[model samples]
Target: MQKQDFYQSLVKQAQALISGERNVIANMANLSALLFTSLEDINWAGFYLVDSPDELVLGPFQGNPACIRIPVGKGVCGTAAHAKETQLVEDVHAFDGHIACDAASNSEIVIPVFKNGEVFAVLDIDSPSLARFDEADRDGLQALVRCFELTLS
Candidate 1:
């Protein structure tokens, strides 16, 4: 499917999921699966939620066993939380202190989630191909994150 069409389908699915009666975790997991399946050349798609002790706890995801704990500013996911912005890293190895949950992940994108203007968590995606993500992905995933945020409250 075209990128735009995929994004629109994602939005529609997210809206329905959020509007349904399932719990947040289920919704998030469904969203992760949707993203993982819709996007091409992706190896990981999931979320890392903030824990009570001010650390990121692994949340719903569709990938291999990943790093269990990530500090507030460590890897791509953590950096997105700390910086409170979306990051599109075309080369994961080139990123200073990149965390290798999966060595095969050559590129990544992390979008920060917010609740009341405070950083809550992140929607992270990883790909095995370099430069797999671009401006269209950044915008589409950001929109996807926004749809997720609406379900939080």
Candidate 2:
């Protein structure tokens, strides 16, 4: 499928999966699994929830075991949460302050998930291929994040 079409379908599927669910953890778990299973070339897909002003605690995930904690502004996931903007890194190795949760992840995309107009968590996806994420991925994933935001609202 074309990238846009694929993302739209994924978003639709995610919406269906969590449509009536109001629990945040349940939504996160399902969304992570949805992304991990639907996306190609990804090694990790999960959440890093805001634990404090400067730290994130790992949440539901699908992949090799990952870092349990990440400080805000420390890595792509943290950076996105801190900045409240998406972090799409084509080369994770070159990003300053990168936290290598998995050595196999060469690229990463982190999207801030907001609640009450503040960052509540982040959706993190890691790929083993350089430049694995593009603008389409960013836009698509941002839409997916919106689905979560709406559900968690």
Candidate 3:
């Protein structure tokens, strides 16, 4: 399927998976699994939740083990959280301070999830191919983040 079409379906699937689920952990777990299994060439897909003002604790994921703790502004995940904006890196090596949770990951996209206008968590996806993400992915993943926000009270 085309990238756009795939993400459209992904958003629907994500919404359906989280429907009627109020538990945050459960939702993040399911969402991570959904993205990991559905997306192509991805080495990791998961979440890092804001555990403190300057740190993000690893949450649910569907991939190899990852860094358990990341300081704010440290890596792609932390940068997104600290900036409260999406960080789409076409080349992980080119990104200064890029965290190498998985050496195989060449590209990455991290979208910060907001709760009441504050960064709550981040949806992180990593691919093994260079320049794996584009504007389409950004828009699609951002939409998925919106779906996640709906689950919040």
Candidate 4:
């Protein structure tokens, strides 16, 4: 399927999943799996939730073993949390101070999840292809993150 169609289907599935249950972790896990399976060339898709101490604790994810903790200013995920905005890196290696959780990951996108105007978590996706994501992906994934945040509450 085309990427746009795949993303739309994912949004529909997420909405259905959230409507049927109010379990945040379960929902995130499902979403992670969906993104992992649907997106091509993706090495990772997951969430990092903000802990009370202002650190990111690894949440639901689908892929190899991942970093369990991340400070707010480090890595793409952490940078998104610290900036409270989306960080789309087309080339992970070129990003200064990039964290290499998986050397195969060439690109990444991180979207901050907000609750009551504060960042509470981030949705992170990494790809094995350089420039794997673009503006369309940014818009679609940002919309998907909104669904995720709403389902959590």
> lDDT (CA) for every model shown?
0.87, 0.95, 0.95, 0.89
User: Residue 106 in candidate 4 has what lDDT?
Assistant: 97
Which segments of model 2 are wrong by more than 4 Å? none
Model 1 steric clash pairs: none
Question: What lDDT tens digits, residue by residue, belong to model 3 across residues 33-126?
Answer: 9999988889899999999999999999999999999999999999999999999999999999999999999999999999999999999999
Clashes of 1: 0
- Predict model 3's lDDT versus the native: 0.95
Best TM-score among the predictions, by candidate number: 2
Sliding window of 10 residues with minimal summed lDDT for model 1: 15-24
Residue 128, candidate 4: C-alpha displacement in angstroms: 0.9
Clashes of each: 0, 0, 0, 0
Alpha-carbon shift of residue 84 in model 2 (angstroms): 0.8
lDDT tens digits by residue: candidate 1, 54-134: 579899999888998998888898888888999999999999989999989999999998878888789999999999999
Judged by whole-model lDDT over C-alpha atoms, candidate 2 comes out at 0.95
- Poorest 10 consecutive residues of model 2 by lDDT? 144-153
Ranking by lDDT: 3, 2, 4, 1
lDDT of 2 at 40: 95
